[model samples]
Target: MGTYDYIVVGAGSAGAVVAGRLSEDPGTTVLLVEAGGKGRDLNVKIPAAFAKQFKTGLDWEYYTEPEPHLDGRRIYHPRGKMLGGCSAQNAMIYIRGNRADYDAWAAGGATGWGYDDLLPLFKRAERNSRGGDALHGGEGPLFIEDPRSPHEVSERLVDAMVEIGLPRNPDFNGPTQEGAGLYQLTQRRGQRWTTSDGYLRPARKRANLTVLTGALVTRVVLEGDRAVGVELEQGGSRVVHRAGREVVLSAGAFGTPHLLMLSGIGPADHLREHGVGVVVDNPNVGAHLMDHPMYLLNAETTAARTLAEAESPRELVAYLTRRRGLLTSNVGEAGGFFHTTDGLAGPDMQFLAGPAYFWDHGFATHDKPAIAVGCSLVGPRSRGRVRLAGSDPSTKPSVRFDYFAEPADMTAMVTAVERARELLATSAMRGLVGSELHPGAAHTTRAELEAQIRAGVEHTYHPSCTARIGSESDGVVDPTLRVHGVQGLRVADASVFPTITRGNTHAPSVVVGEKAADLLRSGVVAGGRAGQVA
Candidate 1:
């Protein structure tokens, strides 16, 4: 048994930041617990080899229950199980989402969560190689860089988007997000740089900070109306670890809700049926799940130099010796945001272009080279839920995305696919690409395209909002991120997003972690002195 000023579960995307930044006060004792090992694997370090880690030991390997809207097919969700969590496993696209995303959250009852309130934190966490400005950060923990060796397909994809009438904006994390350009990566030089590499490891030497790996938390320990500790299994024993001030649950979208239910802070009737005592009876604990549904349009590239050559011995030698090669590619090398429908605050769809065959999560390979253009529905109106499978902690939760459950979502996706076809037909890709491999040339009509979508649609790996922020009537956590009916507890992760952001969620998750630390430091969320980091 152990005790600390704060116990941050999961050591993931946000939890690592919470534990690391909390211990910055020297006076505070912090404990970070993780179920996985260190995130220094070879596959994790190589950007192009990211998909190799899927369904492996480093992944949580979660699969949703058959989604009714997608022809009752189970969608695979691969969450990083190591120190950095999804941030370590993601494509590392350095996008903070459209400014309107935060404004909408603030407008929807999440006060102080507007875009302006978060921009500085986003800046403070990034160290862009291009240097800082009024909009970007120059000196920060995480490193952002340009792709070291983007293939010909990547450059042509950007050109094709522009040739099809999109602006050529160089920076997606700038004043605007509507443009075709190369994506900056969460990388330094050429290797993948995760939050664990940037934030957690640097703070490990602090005497006040403790990191426990291979620890599986059973549940949060509540005393009366407040969370005081947690029960976990480490090594061969079950143990209890107490917190002096707070127990912050950063176990991510799926794990956080699962832990809350296991701790009896979920729906009263549901807990009762599972033979557990209810502490909060909050029916909103695991509701309102969200994710971006994406369909990849693959075409055989007549031109050479795609990810098909990224794994060759020559490229590896270049990567290992000089850190410059195709291995630095994040796969989603170049793309942009665009509105398929008008009257929206920002672009509703995001294009993720990559120079690879990229199907079945990279398990499917082709004899010839190919280029993949992923049309992702970023502003999905569809919602889903997460439910407990059983009382056991080892049991995974049952999640249902219900993708395309909203007709507007399907309409937007189909339009995006049409746009993709238009981009492929452009002069920029005239002789470069030919013969669509997915949604084949045979499927042309809207109805047939929708069917093709249901048959092969995947996600951008951005799962969030299962434990969203709002009042007690509609949400599990409040504006300050503390659970509504529970005391001395808070959530700082993608799970707390009132609405999922308009782009890759890694950057926003980093901001949430930074803000969470600031809140704890100023004693605002602890309720001693309410103040903003600004």
Candidate 2:
């Protein structure tokens, strides 16, 4: 057995930040344990090759056990099992969600998590290509850059939005998120930059930090109510390590909750059902599951100007030599947020445009001249749950995405799809596009669109809120993200978000980690004393 000041579970998106930050103080020792191997795959480094890494050894390809609400189909959830975790495999879109998302957290029991409080941390963690300011920070670890190549389709998409009266926003993470524009990716000089590359890589040189890859944690070793350490299976051998200070759970939305339940820190009846003695009876360990359900509208380009036409030897050469062309596009090249109606107070819909038919984001190869326009409803009113299947640590948790359970959610998605079709019908988009591939012009009725949406909508890859923060009687975590019934344990990921954000959740997840790191390093203190140097 070994000991360290901090034993961070899961070296994924958030864990990387915690391990990296805690190790910054040379006096403290940090141990980062990852179930997967080092994420050095070529696909991980290349900005556009992200799809190639899915379902591979580097991925923990989790699937929901046939969600009954969505035609009883199992949804594919490809989480990264590599060093950077999903940040290494994700589409690289950088979105911090709306300022209201944080403010809502403050209103809903998460004190010190308001927009004004978290903005500085967001700025501090980003090294945006656009440079530093009150809005964008440049000296931080994570790199955000413009795509190496911009497509004409993006221009057409933005033009259509402008025609519809939506402003063209140059930066979505800027002052407001109510416009259409090109998406800035998590890249550095045209290369994919993950949390591992940005945060952990630089911090690895610190003598106090020890990163252990291929170490699968089976349980959090608890001594009474305190999480003292972790038990991991490394090299086919079980080893235990004690934390001198704390065991930080930054294993992300899925992994952390699973680890918690496995270690007997979940619903009492469920733990008893699995024959595992309860440690904390935290009934909300995996409740309130949520995800962004998206409908993709495929259309053939009128002029073969899409990525489909550019995926040839010539384009490959251009990419290899100059880091230019379709290879650098994050697929979801340009998008925007807009209100469905004038009466709405905030944007309720988001469009994710791509110049290619990304059959499961290209997880499966196809030979269709397709480009996808994703229409998603922000702030879905529907909720779902994640539950343990059995007592075994290796068993995958059963996820019920319960998509479109609410009428408003379905209505919003249908309207968003109709809006996307209208945007495509505009003069600018008409000149750039061909015919609709999925729901053709014949399918125009609201019922038909709803059916099509129900049939075609899939996950937008943002699963969160399984371990939400709320008041004493309503939530699993408190204002500081600490588990309600458990001591010396906290969950810092999308799972802790009270409500799903209005955009891609990667940026917000990172922000949660940054904030959690501050809390952990400061002995898990809330506000006022937060952001102070150790």
Candidate 3:
């Protein structure tokens, strides 16, 4: 068995940051483990090639159980399986969500997690190309940049949004989030800047940090209620690694909870059903699964304004010579936040305008010139759960999003579709856009719209809140991220979010890692028992 000061179970967004931060002190030794290969694929570096990684070796490619509300359809959920996790395989959008998201968590039993408390960590971890401001940081590990060459179609869509009375806000991560604007990306000089690239890579050269790829953690090795170490499968060999300080689980929303259940730390009944002995009996371990449900509205373009034309020799040469052109696009180039109704806390609906036919999560692309807008319910009331399919570690978990189960969620989606249609019909989009290809004009009535929504609803790839941070009654982890009823174990990732953030979750996931590092470093070790961090 090997030992270390800290053992981080996933080398994704949060794990990368945690290991990198902890190893900064030469006296500390950190271990970061990943189940997938190194994130060195060309598809991971090119911002526009993110879709190509889906269902490939770099993706976990999880799917949810049939949803009753959506005609019993099983939605595809793709997560990053490589070193950088989803950051290396995502659209690279840099949005921190609305401030109210954090404040609400603070109000709802999560102490010390308010917007005011997290803003500094957000700034500290960001290296925005736009330079430092009250709301942004200029010099940090994660790089954020504007699109190198914004597609004309995306620019026109922004103008159309402004013409339709949506305010023109230059920065979504700034003071307010309610507006239409171009999305900043987690990129640098047109190349994707994944957390592994930004944080882990820098620390890999440090003698104190050890990174192991292709290591599949089977379960946490618990002694009574305290996590002593982990058992993993590396190269078809069973290996045990002990942690001297703590065992941090940054295995993401799905992986983390699945590992917990595998270690017999979840609901007692569920564990017994899977023939796994219960340890903690925490019913909330795999519950509270949440994600943003989205539907795409595609329209044919009159001119060659989409990425279809750019996938040519000329564009390829341009991209090879200088990291610019359509290749630099993050697919979902421009988007904005909007409220379906006024007087709400924040935007309930989020829109993304892509310069391609983004149907079926980009699994199938067309030769025709097209532009698509994604309408998603950012604040979904529908909650779901992740349950173990069996006790075997290799078996994928059973995920049920329970999407559209709440009638109000469908109502909001219907409004979002109408808004998307309006944006496509604007004067600015008159020449650029042609006939609607999805959910044609015939589906106008509420009943028809609802049917169409049910037929085409898909996930936004932002699954979170499975193992949330809250009080003991309804929470799995405390505010400091220490797992309830478990010693020497903590969770830091999107799963700990009390509520889903308003926009893409990439930025917030990285911020959670930065904060978690601080919490771990400053935490005081107490009398042979697990200590409190931050």
- Give all TM-scores, in the order shown: 0.98, 0.96, 0.98
Candidate 2 per-residue lDDT, tens place, 1-534, comes to 989988888876788988888888999998999999899987887767787787889888888877766777788888889898889988899989898888888987688888999999999999988899989899999999988887877877888977877898999998899999889999877778899998898898899999999888889998777677899998878999988776778776777788888999888898899888898877778888888888888887755656776668988888778878877878888798998766654687888887887655566444656668888777687888888888777788877888988888888888888888888888877767777876777899999988877666787888898878886466777877777655666777788888889898889888888988888777744323322222
User: Candidate 2: where are CA atoms >4 Å away?
Assistant: 309-311, 341-345, 363-368, 524-534
Give a tens-digit lDDT track for model 3, residues 178-290. Answer: 99999999998999999999898889899999999999999999888788889999988999999887999999889999999999888999999999999888899989988
Look at candidate 2 and give me any clashing residue pairs.
Answer: 357-370
What C-alpha lDDT values do all the predictions have?
0.89, 0.82, 0.88
Top-lDDT structure, candidate number: 1
Ten consecutive residues with minimal summed lDDT in candidate 2?
525-534
| Deviation of model 1 at 433, angstroms | 0.9
Give candidate 1's whole-model lDDT.
0.89
Q: Write the per-residue lDDT of candidate 1 for residues 1-534, one digit (tens) a residue.
A: 898988999877788888889988899999999999888899999998899999998999999999898888999999999999887888989899999999999999998889999989988999999999999999988999988887778888999999988899899989899989999999999999888888887899899999998899999998888888899998878999998888899999999999999999888898888777888889998899999999999999887767898889999999999998889899989898999988999999999997788887888888898889999999999999888889988999889999988999999999999999999999888898878999899999999999999999999998899889998989988888888877888899999999888899999998889988887776766344422111
Clashes of each: 0, 1, 0
